[model samples]
Target: MTAPAAPEVLRHVDALAEVVGRQHVLVGEQVPARHVQDLWGSDRKGVASVVVCPGTPAEVARVLRLCAEHRQPVVVQGGMTGLVSGGVPGPEEVVLSTERLDSIGEIDPAIATVTAGAGVTLADLQDEAARHGLVVPIDLASKGSATIGGCVATNAGGVNVVGYGMTRQHVRSLQVALADGRLLELSTPLVKDNAGFDLKQLFIGSEGTLGVVTAATLALRQAPRTRTGVFCAVADVAGALELLTAIRAQLPGMLTAFEVVWADAYAVLDGLDLRLPLPMGYPVYVLAEVQGGRPEADSEALLACLASIEHVLLDSAVADTAAELAVFWQARERIPSEILRMQPLFGFDVSVSARDLQDCLERMRAELTERWPQVKLLVFGHLGDDNVHIAVVTGEQTRKRKAEVEHIVYGCVSRSSGSISAEHGIGFEKRPYLGYTRSPEEMELMRSLKALLDPAGILNRGRVLTWGNETDPA
Candidate 1:
């Protein structure tokens, strides 16, 4: 049971209530478990003195001002669908949730843009854009629950990243509440604005440490007339890369997705009792997709491209209809959840150049298996963009040996000159390993910016960078 808020905490809550309203301020038991824990069901949870739901950018600024005055740390949360513990609040901290800012403005078809509150889900924004015969190019498996604010905050990259780019490319402008309670508006709808520095980029992937995103004006693309998806059983990782190169050369910009699933990951589908779209014996599986104006011609072109690389493929399945496409994609999306179900699962998202990806994985697997012979490593991801998701599990107490596993994984990444985090921001979970990717000079520059934007270090205090370190510029 949660203890009652102390008198001082209640006073702080009352001050916060003045900004959002008493009903929107939640304390103690009123705060739901979902607000404090990671949505992926990680054991790392946190405690918030209060959870405030602000309905507007103005309200958000006011709440931040109050928290800033009280020297109270504030954590910003959106859909809570992040795999990292970025949104999880800390003890005695205040949680400023964007849930109530769920408003969508008129879709400007002429400018190919739409303004939406940070609380708006990606799926809702996509639907609204679709109604206008347009689309938000950023796509993710958690679209139904992931909010626009969170996506912008993390600069989320999904399957479409190969063609359309990441969330940073889609974001036109951002309305953010700074740590000092100031509202910074950068809502310019122009396609090219070079008048000054692009300041909105600062908060795009800051993960709420710099400020709280209240709303965004996002760029959209015209809806394609048709989308074709294909699932292929590749001979190996090399063949998968070869096939991807051919598809990109043949289909060009039409190729939106090139996801690769290792045989070990594909086998997990069978364990979950899910129907396998393709046989599980192949060394690697690829889910390729293309969207174009001409349905028939585009489908034929895609099929022809796959046929041209017949020697690299063992077998293939094409999705002629939308229903079949969804079924084919379902197998790829189900890997994360199925792997999470395993006890003491250690999940990692890392990136390397396409040339070194196979070798990096091979070395990491060898090292991990040498330490623990029974370890299972399931790997898959957006091979088109040089990113991969690795899930590891051993029959023993794997959680206790997490550090050892991370060392093996990140060491290989460091040796390969790769990033410790690919799409996921360095939340507290990956905070310690950030050095594996960033240099001392780069880290110092990051701290300087953090101190400049949030001098008090009250916004996401112990996140990406440690709080109150000896080298802290603040």
Candidate 2:
């Protein structure tokens, strides 16, 4: 509740303004609170001593150098759509928004490569790729708002994970600028590079703790010639997984996405503004999609895969229209959007092995039901990647229900050795439960690396590597 010492903070702002110009160095009450935190609810919002927006990587390096001289703790923010609180700023900190650094570089047709700055939103890149008759398979729900840098940093996975892997799998090379003003230009197009070591891989999912990701060369896929979307019903999580395995075996490369939703999730959407095209009666449902290089041939193969899956109870009213595809996606999106709309829900973006998913879900669901009989337990996820999003609804007015559920749910997640976070990077929300998925040795190694890269423990201050001082290793 105390304000920073004015003299030192004002002097740092003055120095930052000198380097990036007064216009780029934002301070005073002019700074909007939007720069404070990311998507998850946390009170980490703080007015930065200065907000430095650089125009290029070189400018970014210079700003970083100046801040390093000031020894000011810095936070990096992109589209600010992350689920964790990693991007949040603290009092007396400086925020570097990649907002003004948008640029599109070369697009090589022979290799399907495109170079873009970190500030480029996923939507803009997709549009540019569409002009070249190509597509980037890595798609996230936050594509409209998330930046390319943030996606690469988080290694995000979207609905298409059944076919195309996570963002880290798609990026060929990365261009990073270290905290001390060193530029690492790693824009390699060669597929097979057995260099001394694979350095680019280090920064892929470090959540900007190691270095600032300025630009990247990404691999693009040839646009799929045809795609099919199916909305089907299954009895339980096991049935859903069985159908997914069967469909994958039948269609092979044709299978794209296999998303499962609990029937109770529909309760969250009811009376809420969220609307769905699928009728709400089944205990569980799936949204499956298939895309192939050949249009007509792929469509035939997809239909065959759908028919071969024996667990499908009833598959009728299949809509082939785009309007129908929109309807299906709307249902999946509604669950998350409604969670944010309805109330403060204790949520998890955890992942267990594909084989362990059913067991974990059953145990978690039964445990939650017993504790809060009237509670609405909603679950939906990208089944292909073995990642799920579980929302246990508790009214915002009562913190006790939320705390009790968080304790029980995370305990199960830990016991399964499932990751506390999947696509969403580990921000502050899951910090306490990190030991559930990681071994003490693994956690120690992470802290050691944190010390090496961020000796001052400044970059992304309290995220990903919290076990160092804040948490006790079991």
The residue-by-residue lDDT of candidate 2 on 340-363, one tens digit each, is: 754656777888887887778778
TM-score of each: 0.97, 0.93
Candidate 1: 10-residue stretch with minimal lDDT:
465-474
**lDDT tens digits, residue span 143-258, model 1:** 99899999999999998999899899988889999989899887486788876899999999999999989999999999999998889998778898899889989988898999
Model 2 steric clash pairs: none
lDDT value for model 1: 0.87
lDDT of 2 at 471: 62
Ten contiguous residues with the weakest lDDT in model 2: 1-10
For every candidate in turn, the CA RMSD to the true structure comes to 2.1, 2.5
Superposed model 2: Cα runs more than 4 Å off:
1-7, 271-275, 400-403, 467-469, 472-474
